[model samples]
Target: MTQQEPAPWDPALAPADADRRLHAPAAARNRDAILSVLRSVLPPAGTVLEIASGSGEHAIHFASALPDLTFRPSDPAPEALASIAGWTTQAGATNVLPPLRLDATDSAWPGTLPPGETPAAILCINMIHIAPWAATEGLLRGAGALLPTGAPLILYGPFRRPGRPLEPGNAAFDASLRERDPAFGLRDLGEVTALAAAAGFGTPEVIEMPANNLTVVFGKQAGR
Candidate 1:
């Protein structure tokens, strides 16, 4: 599960003639480890919204692993959406819905109430550092609106730990990300915690994962 196979559902026709930024390989390598952590943090079964589902790799893997849970994969980019559809076509996965056009910074990110209720979970992975600060704030604000009193908002990514010497690996990774785009770099974990707290989420449960990244679980408190 650590290594992702060639995506099973890439179509011959380019997904709307767009440049493809392949991210599934890395996502494949990390999906299982992430799922292991998710099992402990999430409700036994529910709908999950995965923001920024690049290359559609994680959506495929997670949908296969958690059949009881329906996964909603979303991305702002059209090419990514195509790749997700291609993957879905190949896997014939009933648990994963068609890719949703979603952007974290947008005030109206699309999501629907279930047959009679809101989403059971909101899952975002590797999004904050790649986008601007506004996206991060919007993600928190949107999470507060979508989840119930005791649901969870799960985020996974590499982050800087305040007051600690930077791990060489993380520092180098940060440098590489910034090189790609100055606005993209490692974010501070403490700041994320503060943002979550302000948005009515409880203290985050942080778990160390592969690649020096982490899984931070923020649950909506019971009475806020």
Candidate 2:
């Protein structure tokens, strides 16, 4: 997927109490493509907790499409949470829960789960490369702790692979991200896979996506 400049939500950007809907220009373009991969990997009837859910547009669209699955979208920013709620409300998405404040780097993930609700899948899109390396580690560790065997932890992003030439767009995107924050940039796929294996996830099924993005599907290992 194409990278958007990372900015943690600012409540001042919009009014929380208003019936306004925050829009991400890219969400509409990518949601359908991402949903196709999700449809193949996600469980039929269980909660899907999406990390760093920007704009909440994807959450609403996915929830509407997969009525059998409950969608819980979370972000670290207050404005993002409000936007998520607004979108859910506007869409009348019964399958979506109120957005939770979640920081991917924090060990205490999910902080407040819906009562008696455990995630059947964890969906993270366009987050890792925009955040610190610690966040990716935290995501894997948290998924190891929270997911049961056979449950998938799905990640979508652009990554660098060995012996493969980086796309010009992605190369520039990586440089721009690093210029924004030294800690954030495109990560090596090998390192990510090794980390996931160490975190008790089996080998990932890498699917090519539009815009040089990849949908990496990894399942929780039993009794790790």
TM-score of each: 0.86, 0.91
Clashing pairs in 2: none
lDDT of 1 by residue, 109-138 (tens): 644333453678988888888788788888
Please, what's the RMSD in Å of model 1?
Answer: 4.7
Give the least accurate 10-residue stretch of model 2, judged by summed lDDT: 2-11
- Global lDDT of each candidate: 0.78, 0.85
Clashes per candidate, residues 3 or more apart or on different chains: 1, 0
In terms of lDDT, the poorest run of 10 residues in model 1 is: 1-10
lDDT score, candidate 1, position 39? 80
